[model samples]
Target: MPKTKTERVTISLCPPVDLGGEPGWIPFDAPSLVGESLRFVSGEPDGNRFRARYYRDAEQHLHARIWFGPETEGPPGHAHGGAVAAVMDEALGLAAWAAGYPIVVGNLNVSFRNMLPLQKVVTVESRVISAEGRKVMVHGRIFSGETVYAEAECLCITIPGK
Candidate 1:
């Protein structure tokens, strides 16, 4: 006996979600500014590792719409702490770059608040809090609505003559 053909349904675990549409928000291209050095996190736009879109608000603060994919899982069904830290590392360092500071992250301090669920779209907001001589301080947080997942403070040191 021959088996009949059945329909195959393809469902995406990480579907495209809205970042935001508020006024004074402009799209930002990280690769255009810092080249391919950001390939670690924002490299794969559609890959299972991570998917992120960058933006800037009216105040020039850097914000990102990041999706935690299945590949970033650590806990049974949640994203790993290291994955969250990676997002902070990139986003905060990029925040300094976006603020017209050519620098590298010297120290990254990440504090995990809540475990992040995989395949969910979350927001990471960063701003250059202070800049004095060669040291630039940037703070950021990863959250979904009112639920905060992780927060980080990045200290960036300006490169000489660049």
Candidate 2:
């Protein structure tokens, strides 16, 4: 499969919205940031130039918004399947990390539901289902805007901290 070229975006995250429907300011990088938040996930492997920025949207929700350039093309104008899986793995793993457990993939099951266009933004969402001791189970979906492109389920186990 061909590689996917990605670009990072400069973000201006929105402030928190109050339950009372009023303006509430929550710092983007604050610990107790209510609602969704985004953290930096690394790009493609260091030696590779394809840049993919990942984000942790919440304690249980992880997101990856990707941009692949024209050079990275599959089927004329679609993203490669392997590229999509890689993004899913990274995003889902981070979701596990966000829930206070860093993990390895115990197992992963993915289904490619449709063709995903290249050079467009792709977003991934992951959520933790539950946990058993060091193992956390997760499920996620990849979207091309409002369209579903792929879905995945993963089991992750935390490694002991040094």
lDDT of each: 0.91, 0.61
Best by TM-score: 1
lDDT of 2 by residue, 1-162 (tens): 876988788644222221111123221222232223222223322212133444544342555555544445567778777767766776677677766675777888889998887656566667899998888999999876578989999989888881
Q: How many steric clashes between backbone atoms does each model show?
A: 0, 0
Which ranges in model 1 have alpha carbons more than 4 Å from their true place? 1-21
lDDT of 1 by residue, 6-122 (tens): 879875655565656346779998899999999999888877778898999989899999988899999988999999999999999999999999999999999999999988989
Model 1 clashes, total count: 0
lDDT of 1 at 9: 89
